[model samples]
Target: MKAGWTSKPLEDACTFINGLWKGDKDPLKTVGVIRNTNFTKDGALDDTDIAFIEVEVKKFDKRKLFAGDIILEKSGGGPKQAVGRVVLFDKPEGDYSFSNFTAAIRVKSPDELDAKYLHKFLHWTYLSGVTEGMQSNSTGIRNLDGDKYKAIQVSYPSIGNQRRIVTLLDEAFADIATAKANAEKNLQNAGALFQSQLTTLFNRRAKRATHTTLGQATGGIFTGPFGSLLHKQDYIENGIPLVNPAHISQNGIEPDDRKTVSGETAKRLANYIMRTGDIVIGRRGEMGRCALVTDAEDGWLCGTGSFFIKPSSRCDAGYLVHLLRSDQCKQQLENIAGGAVMPNLSNTDLSNFALELPPVEDQKQIVAEIEEAKESVERLKSIYRQKLTALDDLKKSLLHQAFSGQLTQ
Candidate 1:
């Protein structure tokens, strides 16, 4: 429960300043940007990946921003995901302006509520209850304005309590950050070690390694593409997902932003359907590298630039994925792709490449070990991610209490 603190209408606490919520018409070749991408996940502003737009700032005077003004992303990414992301402008130590799609909230009533505390609080739940109630302006764009934000009901214990809560949150989240950083670093190092191990295992016995095409090592290798029926017109920002070589990775597949195609398109392209245990080998640009499709992604298709491999009973899919991603196979792949602007390999060409068939037991053992190690690394990542999430929730909980005046002794 929140601390029994007095409450104030948001309208009585802050001033909302917003400019044109339109995309640039006559863009400038150079400009300053106030984008949410510049903001890091930890609530700090980072501009390393920002893009410039054409604009003459002198003409868009009201578009400027100032210190203590909190900027909110009106629309971004997917629904229920990127909406309501908040960024407080505390950098450049000077004036700036919000983007056309963003809104800025500035406090004029410093007496009623602490602006810093409110910034923290608003960020804590800007997407909480408010996001669900928001109506999308377009298929995926949702706009959040000052009026809705100001109507947000908030209560705090006191300014002193709010500060204490913020302090506690900062300390706890800092610890979580350090832990997460270390965990992620360890994951990277472990993955590298695994890759190196695979390299040594195969390259060491190069002379003894018998060469065979991917087709010889497997039952058959075939290309994916439900016959170009999934044309460009059927693709969309929303719908059934299709995974191409770009979607596959050494670590694993990530379908977070996987491309979509219409249901009709998918039906026509049904031949590309990925089975639970299907192993996909890249055929274009760095061909022969592979990734396995798991039960979680049975619905998706192994789209273009990918070849599906169904190995004989002698070959293990897990072992093959690791081997394909290894350096030896990469060399073979490069041999074919040599000196080409686009490294592309066909299924017939891939069938000519080969490697030793380790005993089934050895293959099983190696796959088991790799799986165990990867699971451990993923577990470590999960723990750290949870810790980070909890720390954030704790800060919000404390904010709820501190303003309610219950956090004090």
Candidate 2:
């Protein structure tokens, strides 16, 4: 801050803009508040997948927006830090109305402090001191009302310093964006390269080995025949990692979307434990989608919708996952797909499935090569990921410092 410049608290500098329902406004006919959904990590407002309310309500529910105001999400709570999610509202049309889930901030004067600068300042991690760990009325709905917002003390720099901070944010975000893009591209390249290797390895001519059912190749086979009701309502967290046909991924399972079971209920159903090297096949939606458990996890259980493929001999789990994900395997599985809306592969068909088995030595070599390549790719990805995380942290730090008046020449 400049030596002679005086700064005020947020309470004095800004006021909350609340829109009262206008008379004769029919909440039903009128579109409800627009939400600040689809936010970017850098506090950019992403209205791409915008949602709206159609509920009929009184006119007072609509909150109007203006240029230079900050659009803040009402609900808080998540792995995502909610405070400082400052969005600079700059719609030239300004046609969108805000929902009850958001608050609008109107600065005292746009000329005195740039809207962009203020928005960025509000996003600093220091704001977490103001909003983080706050309580909410309901799940997924977090509220940081105007009162707490006012008590926050802000250290203001000169207009010039604010502009400088904004510029720094812009530069930092640009670099972060570029790095993110590159990392994503790299991840795709890694997957493609691995899939290509599989294709090359499996595309060659080999004598068709004697075909046998998946049951014939494995020593044991059993699904969750418990008839226990797991109708999506029974899923509970920290209980069990439930895999169903819907979760089958070429690479493995979508760890994020799995259902959970209670420890007590899962204890009685422990027979369903999925072991390492188990090949899990989706028998319903996305029929024939398969993934191998590269390693074992305790309490990991599969629902009846998934088919457990047990190998008759000690085979490479990585090799099997790659093979199942290969184009050839998918085509074969798809041909056998059956179901009205959600197709599935029956055990009978799986038993007759065949693959041109490579020599044991070749299988070993291929697995080793793939492991090395994948490890390198993963390591590189981890580096970029860490860098991206650090930069984001830096951004938050700068914002906090600016508002606290610690950011000075």
Candidate 3:
């Protein structure tokens, strides 16, 4: 809509080539093929996991990719991600082609339409939600409507002006990318600092502390009720909360009210009820996922896939929770865990596991220090995460300005 800029259908500006597919043939040839998985979220080819598969010779000849070609994802998108992502094929002309789920777009005339400029415009459209209306879902996979995508209105200035816009965008995006990377690294450092504190504080005290098996330090390990003992029919709305593995998060219990049982069912499973200061830990799948039970969750029943530990007077519950969640303990448990499909912990193995126990007072002090360090680390992570989000927003805003002919002049 800017002065002297003309708008035309994308189909008129470029020729679209449907991608290649492997066909049944006696003799075959292998070539590097780019699939949607090779497409990065940043609209670039990853090239690290390109598939080398055999396809019909004739199909490969017509669909092979070249430098300056734009590969468009016409299918294969999730519920959270939209279809119609376009990535620039910057690699040299080689024996490479895209999958059938994608297509290649080549500018018909470089003199009139700049390929880079067109690719940028399409990228902007996808980011701006303009292509959301141009997609439909089938069999849980989102597909871009080819006819609608071809009819997309692309507004552009002269080739000279388009090249100038591309130059400006390229430089600006490079700087933004650097800033985002720094923010991300800072976020990682924030988390690493907390983990370091846990490792250092625990490992340092562990050297001087008396060692004992978990069975000697705790009252007893109570495994959750088996699936046969707790039937699905026992679960009801607005009933006693059950502390399942999913409910254990960030060193604390976060029970889902929907995953509850009736008072009668809780009474029947009273042996599995958690007490205040008890530690609920996941016994299956991911290791080191454990939480401290608060006063509010004292009477909660431990659901299947978890084990509750009641710390004796000698061991501090908070200290024991942190120890169970530590990387060292996780690795130890993984070594003994068993299951054909998913790793699981046995009560006998967990009880026999050796642990370094500091005096109750010393354990509480370490827990307090860790709690303090966690607060500072969380603050730093929040700040860096905000910066990364702002950088993404800025990139989208600049793209909106560029395609609207407001980037320059």
Candidate 4:
């Protein structure tokens, strides 16, 4: 500890005010409400996607926000994100009010405690997992223990030292943010470069090669069993694995043994069973997403949310998978997809889709070339991703030092 420094509970230094939530109302007359969705991943307030609700003017007056007020996300976080994420209000425009999922914290004595410093300390505590530890989960929704959160202690130096610390942190974090942005851009560029290569290869091939409908080139195409035939109740803990759209990733099919059907159920839906060399395309969301079934995934029961393409000897299964994943094919598939609420691809749509057909030998060569390029791009992506992770760790370290008075030394 540093000389003249003291530790005290947060409640002693600040007053906490719970937020409000007005019920549904007409959009024309409703007031804008800032909910947890308004919170950015960087601990800053995001005004985009603000919700609105109708409330009496009298009730609205009490929940109005002001400059320098810190908003704490007291509820509604998931397994990946923890509750108690704090964001400083810089006095955004309009008659802004907060939702019941959040609370506002105002310092009791500004002379003794700086609002910015307190916000940074709380952010530090959140990054340190202190806030996450104080969370309780019920029915999959995580809620912060407000009483315990307010009671948590924080140590600080004198006001002069606090200002200096905050200034140093502000400068350091700004640099860290720039570095993180660059790393993220580079990561994205690596992926884009790989996609560009894939597009160019396919584009050039399309120019010289003969084109044919997907059905003409494939052995057969079929969708999985209808929802009425196979219900969620049919899923068994230990049975035939079911491959859904979620199971198909860019990498390949990721089979979940837990999401399975009994042998009898699988037999009943035998016509929908996928075999080795079959190309599985998602029928619902992310219409372009497709994966090739390897020997390991053969005989898996295809879920209702997918389509199976049994490739003929004329087309390589791996090449077909890569073709469907490309931007060109994705755009075409998306065009024919039905339903505004949930876009989907029907069997007729898949069978009629035009595809460039090169020689079987050429298809193998193209797949090999793309695979090699993908490996290089993935390596670059991994390096940039590691740098991003390191930058986050660096910020956490700086926060720990600033709060513990090590930075002052």
Highest lDDT scorer: 3
Each candidate's TM vs. the true structure? 0.72, 0.74, 0.89, 0.94
Best by TM-score: 4
Candidate 4, pairs of clashing residues: none
- The Cα local distance difference test for each model comes to 0.67, 0.64, 0.88, 0.86
Instruction: Judge candidate 4 against the unseen true structure and give its global Cα lDDT, from 0 to 1.
Output: 0.86
- Model 2 TM-score is 0.74
Give me the displacement of residue 78 in model 2, in angstroms: 2.7
Evaluated at residue 88, the lDDT of candidate 2 is 71
lDDT of 1 by residue, 1-409 (tens): 3545766667766666664343555543244567767656555557676555555545356666666677777766364465667777766554456676667777776565666677777766653455546535666566665466677776765667766766765676677677767766765676676667666654554554455656777777778884455566667866777777777887677653537877777787777777777787777776656788787777777778788876577778888887877766788788876657778886767777766766666677777776766677667667756765665676567655554555565
Worst 10 residues of 4 by lDDT: 21-30
Taking the tens digit of each residue's C-alpha lDDT, what string does model 2 give over 80-173? 5554366776776634566555667778876576777767766763345556644355556656655766666555566787787777667767
For model 4, residues 219-301, the per-residue Cα lDDT tens digits are 98989888999887998886888888999998888878789888899889999988988988889988788888888888898
Candidate 3 to truth, TM:
0.89
Q: How far is 85's C-alpha from truth in model 3 (Å)?
A: 2.1
Model 1 TM = 0.72
